[model samples]
Target: MLIQTLAAAATTAAPQNKFGFVEALQAGGFIAYATVSILGIMSFGSFYILFTKFFEQQKIMRQGRDVGTSFWKAPSLRDGANKMDKNSAWRQLVDDGLAAEDQHGKMTDSMEAHDWLHGSLARSEASINARLAGGLPFLATVGATSPFIGLFGTVVGIYRALIAIGLAGSASIDKVAGPVGEALIMTALGLLVAVPAVLAYNWLQARNKRIAENLNGFSTDILANINSKGAVRPAAIAPAKSAAPAAAAPIKK
Candidate 1:
């Protein structure tokens, strides 16, 4: 019944009685109609980028959490590196630190430990930002460009309306309203496309910032663990003194 009613309404709008996207578009006045087409394309691409990036960032955050938890539980730095989830960005940082050093290498103290942590965290954070920022440029473009596209349609529509007025030699409500109304449709469509894109851009930026903080927290935790283990040296400290006895004696004199 609803479909039939809609069909009837569509028929009243057109001479041949058909309901379709093209037909509805034709009724939209030329400028308004063109605005719809341009905005439609931009909105499609913007949404695709927005959703895909959202899920991708979420997955990265989850994996980062897993990596941080696993690193804290491991017995040693090497062990932590091995135990961490491979997919986590933090895990990659640990891997980089370990790989940069030799088998006998160790973090030593708070400063070196901090350096390693900082480097690891910085690298991962940079990467996460890059990923999070992905496709945002397109959204920015859509937001900026859509209004102009609409304005162009409106300008064209107004031009046609003016021409019609000249040709008829009289200003009739029907003649003026139809073309002018159609042109204003383009501007409305442009706003429809731009507003959502701007909102999405702001939202994604906040999300990326939160994710960066999480990654930084993980870096600090890894460094703290390294500092804790650094304090536990050999009980005697004998080897260094014995190996440099002559040097020790000169200092004692």
Candidate 2:
């Protein structure tokens, strides 16, 4: 008699074992449906930003390399400056140096040369920063909001499970497990979407900063070359042809 009863209980438990969070979702609970929807959108948005940012940063680095090499090779600012595309900041700085030389004859002070170089450098810095910052807003949005979206889904799932228990007039694993399990899936999904976005954002930001430093170094080199050509004042001045100008003044006394 004991064996027969145990066998009957096992047969009844088999159907409950087959139930899962997916099966619970199919059972028409608002909580499960909403959780799935939010997770889908968050995941898609995160991936889109990741790939887009990757391409943008890669392109900028390539352009930087090209610009760096060309800036050094030009015979004079005017000659090589024209070879660079407008997007190349290093080339623009070289052009600025040439223009300053043409206007001022020579750079008497380092401060004056830097002032002439400032326009091109500032413009390049702004543009590079703008490109690097692309897609970061979306990454930030996902990181900040994905968890809340998932929590919203979880809460709904739990509430639905509680209601199901009340309506069925039972508090048993068969009725409660599926819904609770479904709710927790949302939290997991939220973390899944958020972790990568946060990490990618930090990584990209660091790379861009390094690029900025490289560009800054290049700018200094370009200016130094321009100064070398004719910008520096000679170290020694020939002594005034005879006595001081005052002594050479008419001998009124």
Candidate 3:
């Protein structure tokens, strides 16, 4: 009788939890599904940005090597600019400097031409930096907000659990475990999503800073060259007015 009673008690004991993520999702309802979907999107977007930006930065860094060798070896500013990859940041800055030198004389009330050229280079550098920083804000948003979204789902799960308990009139392990597991899963998923986003944001930000620093240094070199060699005349300068032919003087001969 003792052995039989023990066997019956063991059989009645709660079965091992075969329940898992899918079951939790099924029990969590629409709110849980939505939360997971949003987190999934955030994760995908952050990873995509991280990878694309990494490749872009790597390309720029490699271009830096080319700039060091080929650009300086060229005979003139135009030649140096041509030696750089056409789409490179260094080439862009050089082009802007050349344009600024050409256009400075045309702007009424402009500062000294040197100052104008420097300002144009500065603006070009800023534009490149801004382009490099694109998509970073979205990573930051995901890092900052994903946890809250998860917490919101957790709250909903707990509320549902309470309702289930109330309806069943008993807080048995089976009734309580599924909802609690769902809530915990939501929290864990949130942390998982947020951690990568935050890491990627920081890593990408650091890389951007390095790129920006490189751009600033390159711009400075271009400005120095412009200052030393006098601005390269653009193809479009108007012919200098020839001094009216010395007023064909009376034939004093």
Candidate 4:
């Protein structure tokens, strides 16, 4: 009988959770839902850009490695370009350089062949850099604006709390807890959405800078090779030579 009475008393003493996430959202109504939806979209877009750009940068880096091995070893510019992946940025630069070289002869008497070729390759480099930079602005936007977006929800939540207090004639816990919780959720959500976006933006931007540097150096090398008519080539990256085994010791000691 004592155990049964204790169980009943324990059950009756436990308080219900009226100030939880669901309750807060329920109190905030349309404004809370809108904030969550917008944040969700921003988070999704940020991750998508991060993953896609990372893979793209990695592909270019791998292609950069292959340039010294497979590319410069070929007999001519045409042969070297054919050795690279056709869709690679390096291949595009080579094709543009070759095309420019072909057109340099057709320019008017006043235009120098070297200047025209240089200008063509520079334009090609700029275009590739621009293409690599395509989706970065969305990341920047999310990073910069997500906090304010969340703040808007917070402001609305606070306003609701104030209204509830006024209607109830006192600032009691029950009257204010839901809206206050909602406001905090908005602030936290804003931070969560913004941090990852800012991190991704910085990381991808750094990768792009590295790629651009590599592209510039490669472009310069290509121009020199083309101008010197296959006489110039960058150092080739040869595979490591295995150490030969020592001759077996004489059988007799």
Candidate 5:
């Protein structure tokens, strides 16, 4: 009899929703939907920048690796330029250097020629680095502002909750549940948007730094090659396997 009475009372109590995301938004009206839409756009933009920049960075780095293998193997600057993709950043640098070389002949002294070539390559490298850095500011802005945007929603939700209390003349669960849930959801969504943007910004910036360093190194090599009239190239280290085979062959013979 006691168990039956408790079960009947449980069923008699108000039936609450199992999920409230939709309900909470509806309760908050236009403000809730607007906030969500803004966050959605920011999330989408952040991902787009991250992916586009990553692929671009990867392409430049891949080209840099190819330079180590094939670029130096060419006998002359004009020959090396032919071996690279015409559209590539490396190709642009070589072309600029060659152009500067041609024009530098009009200069009276060897120092003037060297300065002209160095400045041309430096300018080309700087332009490439600047291009790579283009979308990073968007990621930074999203990371910094998204949390505040979310806080605005939280503040609005809290205000709504207060209004609900005043209207009902009581702090009832039914009266304030929607607004409180909205507040929590806004906070969580803000964090979700912010963390990824911050991470991507830092990660991509680090990679850009690495790429810049490699570009600088390559620029130095190119400058040396230009000044030396293709006489100077970075010495290639023999692979350990090739050295071991040579050592063994000598002993066997």
Candidate 6:
């Protein structure tokens, strides 16, 4: 009798892992499966963009230090440009500025050299910004749409639960729990996917904005230097002297 009681107690105490993700998938039909698959794809894409853009931004930041030290200190604009990393945005801007100086007459001889160089640098900065902004749209899309996708799954799950209650002819715990749990899981999954994507998108965009500001400031400095010393022969600039002659008093008498 004691052995029987212990056996019964052990059986009752055994934990039941109920209708989890796999079970939901099994019972959720094609719509549920498709929704999950789409969310999975979106998650993968968001993470990929986040990581790639992160590394890319870090590279640009490191290049910023290089530009401040090596590029600015070089003797000539062309030499400064050459000192930069070959494929970096800073190098590209410098090359564009030099090219503008070289090709000043090709567009129209009437345009001032300052304006031509400014326009070229502007264009280069815009190109770099556009490149940095790539993949951001995908992250935005995922963040915006993932919740709706999850809601769709939840609605479907609830609908299935209602059908299940109808078939069982009772709204008991067993009848209500499975479908409700599945629906809640869908909602949770959707939020899980969306929150990170939104956070990552915002973070990346903020970083991009900072980088763009730096680029614009750098362009402005380059333009100022060009105006002051001329892009080609920066070393030849000389300070202007006052027109007044020194110690000219009585010699004329």
Highest lDDT scorer: 4
Q: What are the candidates' C-alpha RMSDs?
A: 11.2, 10.8, 12.5, 7.3, 6.6, 5.2
User: Residues 1-253, candidate 6, lDDT per residue (tens digit)?
Assistant: 9999999999999988678888888778798889889999999999999999999999999998777667766788888787777889888887887787779858754888888889999999999999999999999999999999999999988998899899999888888777788798889889899999999999999999999998998887777777777443323232345787677468654
- Scored by lDDT, model 3 comes in at 0.85
What TM-score fits each model? 0.68, 0.68, 0.82, 0.88, 0.85, 0.84
Query: Each candidate's lDDT (Cα)?
Result: 0.69, 0.69, 0.85, 0.90, 0.88, 0.86
**Model 4 C-alpha lDDT per residue in residues 1-253, reported as the tens digit of each score:** 9999999999999998988888888888888998989999999999999999999999999999998878887888899898888899999999999999998878677887778889999999999999999889999999999999999989998999899999999999988888888999999999999999999999999999999999998898889889988776665533356999999988985
Tens digits of per-residue lDDT, candidate 5, 1-253, equal 9999999899888696933889878887899899988988999999999999999998999998999888888888789889998888888888888888888887776667777889999999999899989989999999999998888889999999999999999999988888988998998888899999999999999999999898888887888888988877776621234444444445554
Residue pairs with backbone overlap in model 2: none
Clashes of each: 0, 0, 0, 0, 0, 0
- Candidate 2, residues 1-253, lDDT tens digits: the string is 9999999999987665445667767753675677678778877887887888787777657877775456445555576667777756455555655666576545565557556655555665567577668778888888888888888877877887899899899988878777777678777888888888788778877887887787676666666656677343212221235655555556676
Winner of 2 and 5 under lDDT: 5
Candidate 6 ranges with C-alpha deviation above 4 Å: 1-15, 230-253
Deviation of model 3 at 129, angstroms = 0.5
lDDT of 2: 0.69
Lowest-sum lDDT 10-residue window in model 6: 230-239
Q: What lDDT tens digits, residue by residue, belong to model 1 across residues 1-253? A: 9999999999888775332445435755554555787789999988998899789788877776666355555556677677756666667666654553332255454445456556655776687678679899899999999988888877876887798799999888766666677677777878888988988888887888888887676555545545555443223321243454454445544
Instruction: Give the clashing residue pairs of candidate 5, or none.
Output: none
Q: Per-residue lDDT tens digits of candidate 3, residues 133-182?
A: 99999999999999999999899889988998999999987887888889
